[model samples]
Target: MYRTSWSCQSRFVIHRTLVAYRTKGMPVPRPRLMLAVILFAQFVIPLSISGTAVALPEIASTLGASPTPLQWVVNGFNVAFAVCTIVWGVCSDRIGYTRSFQIGIVIAALGGVLSTFATNIALLDTGRVIAGIGSAAVLTGAAPILSHLFHGADRAKAFALFGTINGLGLAAGPALSGLLMSAWGWRGIFAAHTIVLLLALVGSMRLPLLGRANTSLRQILDFSALKAPKFLTMTLVPMAGAIGFVTFLTYLPSALGAIHSLAAGATGALMLIMTIPVLIAPVLVHRVLERTRITPTGIVAASFACLILGGVGVLMLLRPDLPVALGVAPMILLGLGFGLPLGIVDAEALAAVPAERAGAASGVINLFRIGSEAVFVALFAVILATVVTTALPGRSGQLVASGEHGHPWIYHDGLLAAGITMIGIVIVLGIVFFALTRAVSRTPALGEQLGEQ
Candidate 1:
């Protein structure tokens, strides 16, 4: 009887073990490995975005493309990234985050293959677009995977790493691209990019699954958050920066080449003055928030002031009379202006709405943020090209816009026109931002607002 009882208990324990294993789904990678993979993937997306700017001159020279088509090399990526980010966000919910992220890596690697071998400008831009779409999936899938993998303090740390990795990529992109371009020419940059993506893809294969999809949470795009005036105003801050700063960031290498006749290596080194602040300013802003009582609104106001000055300061480059060193100060100012309110505004915007709508609010704000970048950057390029056409007309104007060696005087009118146009937009945005911030009461911390939920 004692032997029979022991056998029954052993069978019962084994049965429970099997049931628990099935309930938890398939075994996955250890959490630490997953974190590393997610962070690695995050780093490359922004690297690809900002690094490609350094390659534009080479692409132009190699393909002999005109200005308008050349602009698409950058714009095609931005527009595709902006649109696909939303699609990937929704798809992650249905197909599981791990799968979505793996698919993204595969697609991006394929795109890099195309980019590495392309002989024509059109083929190159198409590769960039495919890469952009894949980048969106990686970004959208990261947060969900991290959220599921960690809890409380660990979760916060994981996200902090996420943000830091993004900033690092943006900071390091141009310099790395320049190094590769110098060593093996432009195709080397894309080849290195492809290699990195393939490594990420291999790592992703080990990621633990997040179980079956949660189809019950399906909801369409929600814009109910836009009704709040304060939220709307806060959203405009980044949009303003997108117009005032990102456009300049993307095209500055070309501008430098045009004005100072610098080579690709030198231009990339110079861009560090602008991008390094973007990497560090968020940390500075966080410290200031903790140590002082300065309001988010005040911080934003200061950001606006910096952007306006930075815009005007960049116009100094258009003058043949000013020293090139003067450009450094404005570049730092623009970087600070964009970086000061980086993560703060997103939290503040979400805090403005009801707790339940926080997710929707985030989606709305991101869409606007990306859409503004796509629209304004395209506009900036078009305005610059149009002005150049009017001044020089036909092929000479096209060549100058494409960053071929040209007299500094030829770029003066085009740069001046584009600079002034951006400044005017920033000023108008500032006026609206200030008015709306005053209309609302001081915002509470996001943690405080969302505590009940």
Candidate 2:
């Protein structure tokens, strides 16, 4: 009787284990719809970022702000974006992905409404800061959730799609801002504040939520994530990339305006040209990498070299004497460098945490990206201000202050200096990425376990 009772219990426990395994693996998702929605949510914040750029001069003039203060108009939002990303990343890990995204969108909308009514630059910057915080939440939460939604080829494709949307946001921001400005002056750009948030809100409602992360909150927030050499390389290299990215793109529009003697409308068109290549690179890059069977690390290192050369080219080509297309040629290399690493680093971030902790990991990395961009933008602005202050006579300064005058040569020179700075950063970024890739070969533990999920 005792033996029989023990046998029965063993069979029962085994049966329960099999059923539990089945339940855990159940319900794969549809790739197409999932990718689309995630991409759409990601697009909102970047759109808001670039869309407001074209209207900055008008905003500066109307607010009676000087050049240095006006540059903060952009920095304020990006700073808040950086500060809040890690916080939101943790929130998404604790609460859930879909719900966290919804909160972020809501916060962005609130910030946007406040911004559209600003009486001066300070209030306007306040609105931007608040909106940035909200954007950080949405951005940090979205990427990790996508990692959960798809895997393998499907996952790679989703990343490609995400890349495309990011490209559009970067490319379109200035042109869209200019279009709105043409129709209704600077305030028109603020109109997108309502638009992107509304779209993000709708998308959030439809987005599917995933399982809770398995880690304790303390583990999720700790520095362990960055302590590993590979992870550290992934984190810091991207920061350098971001510094280069903002240093170029943020000031490019202002660069073009001065060079071509462009009207706001013409300047917007050129901004569109610089950004268009980003959308196109992902498809080509994925195919090239796959067909060549090339390692991402080698490509990333090579890309840095290309970007350094290309950045120099843009600075030199950003001349009154050169054709407009020549100035934009350098961006092609920059955009190519940009797309690959973004996808790879994003993957690195997801792989650093356990499967259950993807949301939290994503939040951390996204915060890293946002914080880096914000600081870089602020640094670039400060640098530009210092250079510009000494370069301009008081009478010349007032002309720039008016928003009606143009300074194509001075803009080019300032931009050349900015390009040199980015190249210096790229050298450091390259060293880190290269070291991390080599580390992965030795730490098979890091590489092998990453894809196990």
List model 1 lDDT by residue over 110-206, tens digit each: 8889989999989998988898898888877776666555543354455557655655665567778877888888899889989988888889877
lDDT string for model 2 (204-234, tens) is 5545554464444454444555655666667
Q: To one decimal, what is the Cα RMSD in angstroms of model 2 from the true structure?
A: 8.0
> Residue 307's C-alpha lDDT in candidate 2?
69
Instruction: Tell me, by TM-score, which candidate is best.
Output: 1
lDDT of 1 at 41: 79
Q: Score every model by TM-score.
A: 0.83, 0.79
Cα lDDT of candidate 2 equals 0.63
lDDT of each: 0.73, 0.63
Model 1 global lDDT (CA atoms, 0 to 1): 0.73
